[model samples]
Target: MYEATDHPDDDVVAIGPADYPHVRQFVRPTRRALLLASVKERRDGGGEGSLYLLDAAHARRLLAPERPVELIPIPTAYRLDDLTFAVVQGLISADNALGADDRLLDAEEQGLEQHLQRERTVYAREAVPGLSQVGAAWLGSRFCSRHALRWLTKNGAPSALWSRAQIGEEVLPLLLFRQQHQFIDEFTKLAAGGDEQPGVVLCVPEDVVAASPLYQRILFFLALAWLEMRGLVTWVCGEPEYAKSDEFVLVPGEQAVIGTWMRAKDNIWSADVAVRKAQVRDFDLSVRHARAHSVTQGGSSHARLRAAVEYLGLEQTWGTLPRRCAELGAYGTVDMLQSRSRLIALDEVDRALRYVGGLGSA
Candidate 1:
């Protein structure tokens, strides 16, 4: 009842609802696989395809390992489940199913999904991919918690980084303006911009925030990205002992509040929408770049975009980000991502990130 057509520049493996449970089992451990699954019902039902980043080796290891599941293969990439397989494109190596091209710089040889792209250098990849919230916090902490603590105890992010607001105004992708064409350079512009764009204040649990500078940086960017919004994020098990070590003011928000998730309920909802909104921006950027990358080039940009989405943990926002990117113009937004479901104070929704963890981790 459903078709698994690959996105023009992306390497997708589409499945059905019956495959959900099977896929879900791999969600936590594998957050790096780009999967599309749905259940067509007797009524008007639709399927949702989320892109997950995969640890090619890890993903391959996690495969059924039975060998030769009966499925057709694609020319670009191969698909293998409990059934057959196919090769859709070039270089669908047997060892790394996700394909080994990490750190995709010139997507020119890869492919194109569009004519032009607002080029930008991503100084670094997503903060950390393929991990649970608590897991992310823990990883973040060991990654120079002392420095992160210094930032907090010192009263905030290095005034240099925090005071200089970056990102965007409508709380969107002002970060991708083609002129600058590099993340840090453009971010430098965002920071130097006179007025702060409206951004939601994200609150991660103190322990996790202190534990991870990358985690703190993510939240820091969130605060600097806000303009007209007054939102709050709550870390469920925040430890006040680390209060002095929690200097979020470094990110440039209006005010800082240290209440529990209970007091920040509305703020939590508002913040989730804010981040979901930004994810939309990132999604649009990826798709456009993918089109610009095209099939002639190897269609890698599309694949990379899908990976980036998973890396940033925006899987659920998949459907909205792509569609909104298309039908809506620069100013258009989505109604669905604005869910009222009491999301976590941090980006802690129980969904899979679908990307490999520790690609660049030391």
Candidate 2:
């Protein structure tokens, strides 16, 4: 958790654990990451997503904090990629005043427009074939209008460009090539039968998903979900991050990578969520609007009682795995990944809400 003095304008820096020495020791060219606010798409065929690596300085300024922002250094052995740079740079720029200020907004807006025009021209000449120059312009225009380009290119928007670029570069390729969808369609066709009950859509949890190629396949998930709604195969969501369980399908295709993420998700459980696993640390210090009140409750109060019961239930059923792992002294980074995954799980969220609801009912 962050300290109380952190200011809103302060930078929230994150480096891989490997990169910590660079910030701590001021070593050579250590890579660090910062987050900007989230962004949404503004055009048709556009879906909600995030932009990244646009403007770092601006992000540091706009998202002020209550404590001095610290950089999170990641482990160096973790290979870096081009997409990482694209994300970090875009996110940083998103937090800048140039993005939000109305006075200079037009200039920034024009620059974004020009960048899109250039990218489209490059894509047409380099990406599409058999199109004459004039024809290419028309085709590109049809693919994305000036209005759409303007919406996508606006640099200040968080995650807008990130998600679009990802959709364009990764998801569209998979969908258009029919590489993965062939399997999806096959499953869908199989599901239309009267005797079939389509199984859960299997996937690694989001963190593992983020680390894996599946991150790029988010669009594929969305598209397939739509297909499933039309009587396609059922999409059962799975956790690639945890040990393969009977209730979920394990994604078996990730052997190509080093399996670092898989190892991370299977780490031993702890009595509480570990300190290093704290993903969101809210630091709010504004003097309340004179309407703040403190509410006290006992540990066995309705909220705690239900959460404890549900948590104990999960522990009783699934506890053997973690307990066995812990007995073997297998604590490691996977604990962090698993805890994070649980924090984001739909089932976990629903369970928590139900627990709270039960408390109110009681």
Candidate 3:
């Protein structure tokens, strides 16, 4: 059983596995009323004692009814189950429930584990000079296909390196040092060194590398190359694509690869490029920044607190007072606090306001 942590200033609702199903049902645009009802009930004093209300009008606008669901293409179909989508959907649900706040370190870590496991398993099939041949074969059968092999051969051999390198030597170490995980640290170092790039910078956490699903990464990497070959991203790689045409929504990871290809001397377009370019876009750039910021911060404190007000109402929300307020007080990490106060814009709960404002203020 997961206990709801104290996070009064947050903007999202933290539900355990039991509350997930209830939350999931309201995951669509048409069901805004259902969510509104839930929030209304909370604001009017119902259910859990600990809660807060948000400005529903603002919440609706921030969520935007017309925004289509973002699709994150995992490397393998095995990873594309309801659970995976559920997690993504949960993260996107609402500012009160799944706002931009909250620590995604858990999700990022889970994704990393899945990535490493698949990477090791895939390379398990081939007859490595001194490795587990049977395991390698089983992994190959489970994840990789002949098509993947051909792409590895044709492209700059991303997969081939996995086959040849010893786990600890090159493969395992690199995975351990997730480039994304170290991104912020690296960013600080770069910034300190005064090396900021003017181009569209897609910053990912060093902890959460998009390489969990090798195929997904390959597809995106290759797609970027193809776009670059087509001269869409431009050689300098600073041009934004969303302004060009409404039809051409650049999916995540597409621009970077295209930028790379535009910079490449040989310009060998990988077949995986064809498979992945369709999923590329500019939204990912924002996601990358948001995600990194979220990881550093525990979650959106303002979103959480607002949710508390919406769900608990003024009187009932008071029950959440001590714990939630304290949790917000203890919020560790510079990023988590930033997400709460800076990103989500939550004002501290004034004790005088809580007492004097009475039930009306909540």
Candidate 4:
């Protein structure tokens, strides 16, 4: 959508006929997010999750194409969080640099021993409205702040004091007041009441929108997916800018936010992911990775990612893998495993693998 004229008044963006069966994903504020990265036990009884509006700049910088992610050093400020709060530190992301320069690393760590706290507050990071960063916008709107709230804030505005509650503000409730377990279930819950509108069209003030630029729009889609479960569909328009004739906040056939979230949890039928969707994207790669680990170590690897691996043709030669369910007397290419006595058609391999399931325990 354009930044100059588009404005959608409807609850859901009116999708066009040309755009059918399309889905879109939501984006997160690149600079920060209220992540439930750690859990702290409450002295009272139940444990409370520690929410961090993780500053992703260092992490993003490490992954920048210009430098090798492994070589880059995480700022002392980030490392300090791990030592002090006893929270996750060193590498927030898997792609982050593991080792800092030995020469200054000790000094940096020593100096930060006392000062490496939430050196920067949640207030320091300008977040997009409607996302978990919504905490800041919601809180700040009720009071006067030191920095100018972007009519969306990407131009570099400072925010207020940080608080963990802000990050858990929205997500905690969605997950039934517990740390996340089933992401798809959490999002889909919004539709449970059956009041889900086809989609939600956000009418955000430009300042409330994220001011940061995302190189990977899929990140936005990942976050947007969470928003989609609220309705059968999801659309967004930032006003004036997206209110154009040819453009929409997003339109029909236009990728709807609802399908985007589904894509994250469910495998696709066609299997060609979006270019931005082109790469793997998730709100929390760690959580998904953990689930993957559980699936694998728990003796379910054959059922988990192997199908996607096969669909992508990453491990085997598609037509060459031999399959003999010999007991059933069917012998053919892996794609034709079900062909009783007939030859398999290479062109139809995708269709054959479409509904494929677990390869069974190793």
Candidate 5:
């Protein structure tokens, strides 16, 4: 085990195997020292986990061997929260860099409901597309909770989940997008080509038990998500069939505003309301009237059309789509329109209108 003290020169102490007989036999001396030090730090910190910076070699030694490992450095920041947020942002940015159409898929705009409905029919047939015989049996077993399936359908990429092997007694949740899968495959190929790849290792408190089935699953899912965000690893699965159409209407201007609004911590509701009013004024009276009528009559199509127009107007007016969409809770609509815009060849305005109309029909 590891011990720590206030001494600046001797902050960490490593205990040998004599003190802890059950310690894993294969752990090298240097890793043993690091592990002991980490344990001491955790103990001193009252069991709360601490993050450690592991080198690529150390990371490969410690992390699961089933996948290639690479270490990405966490930026030095004053606050832990800021550090965490930075990692999340980095993940999002990396995913976004894959290009708009190849980014992580959002369930709300991707016909997750329809996918689940289809899964129900497939479940009845005993022939789910992606599951191995062992995985199918495991899925058929009682341990797979309805609540877990419900959560996956509503919040995650269910196609990834359906496509993976689920063999063991304990099944971990898989949440990933199609582009992410491609990203991982490419990384794996590069690693296989003998490229010196770095990887990330998550350091946690020694006292923390990750052995419980539920806890392990949760931990696994979270770790996988974090890594996926960093473009490090992907959940093993077959290629997911996208249920949504490929056609997307591209907004010409800066799209950073959407991300900015998403990351904003301050209340911008009143400001958003004012901006939205200004946005509506850019539309013709007929469009404005239609929006008003839709608001009162619960006609979502007209409202969506107005939102699409407003989004385009916001794009034209330096970047206000974020605040407007956040205020209206129309992220799904905007995402749908943007996604459809990327798929087919149409002028901006015509594409936006057709997308809004198509969304209404869908």
Candidate 6:
């Protein structure tokens, strides 16, 4: 049993476990409410609503603690299985209300529906092999790309412009550029203030720091943001330009060690050890700005590697490059990169590699 609270905004409702004695008979002992609490406490000092739709045990495990709960303001039941259906349907409804062309909207809606059906089939199985680890990484990337596309559309960007753009020749470089300037602007503000202590653990949830490879990627970005905020690393164009003096250590909260058969029993490493290892290498992280050309399977290994290296260099001084391309409608780039399975304009691979590589003129 549960209690429901209504807000002025009918779309947002709060439901929590009921305290009534009779409620125990209706609810199962193993069942728990899938609540989404804020990582950061509310500034108003008010408690968050305990609204939750029941989820399966497996689905519950996927609920990341660091994930900010975004309630979709729709009438449909918010279940994990129905999430895609709910969101896509909501988008379709909005488009219809706006008097958009039915033909264009119908085509896009059908494509989204098909993808959702495939995803549903995969998740419907009782136990998916390697889903907990490998699947999370793949799913996270897809989610990030989709979320970026949704962000653009919701913010009033025309979807058609980016949806039809070439991935390697247009989208990849633009995303890298957007991310670069975001870091630059943030770091500049921090540089104005004094530097902080070297060794500081980022304030992420314990589960987030140790969860999955996807969370690890998120943690990496968060740590990078923290480092940038302290002005610990230098930026040439839009990428972190490491210097000999630029050295710092970040420790994640609640350390745990897990071992695989591939490694020796005595060679176990904790989360902090990994973070330290990343720092020692001067954070020479790979840049995969787009899915289409970033992965080896999508393009020639040699070309992708060269492009990645060149992109890193460009980040240091190629600040305005992405902005220039974006002015010509790079908004739909994310959708094309993630949603489209087949690689496009493979012949442009060599040309794009040379073009991006040659852009390191600064």
- Model 6, residue pairs in steric clash: 162-332, 236-316, 237-316, 237-317, 238-315, 239-315
Relative to the unseen true structure, what is the Cα RMSD of model 5? 22.1
| Candidate 6 off by > 4 Å | 1-5, 9-12, 16-220, 227-266, 269-362
State TM-scores per candidate.
0.20, 0.20, 0.19, 0.19, 0.19, 0.19
User: What range of 10 consecutive residues in model 5 has the weakest lDDT sum?
Assistant: 254-263
Give RMSD to native, each candidate.
21.8, 23.8, 21.1, 27.9, 22.1, 23.7
Clashes of each: 66, 52, 50, 38, 18, 6
Model 2, position 141, has a per-residue lDDT of 27
Give, for candidate 3, the lowest lDDT window spanning 10 residues: 159-168
Tens-place lDDT per residue, model 3, 156-193, is 21200001111111121111112211321232222232
Where is the poorest 10-residue window by lDDT in model 1? 82-91
In candidate 2, position 359 carries an lDDT of: 31
Error of 3 at 109 (Å): 16
Writing each residue's lDDT as its tens digit, candidate 1 over 339-360 gives 1112111111100011111111
lDDT of 3: 0.25
lDDT of 5 by residue, 1-362 (tens): 23322222432223333423333333333331222223334434576644322222332243444643332222111112222222223223333332342232222224334433331212222223433332222222211222123322222121111111221111221212232233334334333333222222221121222232332322232333334333332222111221111111011121000101110123110011112333323322222232233211223333333332332222242143223222222212221112221221212222222332233234
User: What's the lDDT of the predicted structure labeled candidate 1?
Assistant: 0.25
What are the lDDT figures for the candidates, one per model?
Answer: 0.25, 0.25, 0.25, 0.22, 0.25, 0.25
Residue range 119-179, candidate 2, lDDT tens digits: 2222214333333332222223222333232322122111100011112122322222222
**Candidate 4: lDDT over CA atoms?**
0.22
Model 4, 245-347: lDDT tens per residue? 1101111121211111111111110011111332223212322332333211222323323432332222443121212111111211221111111111211
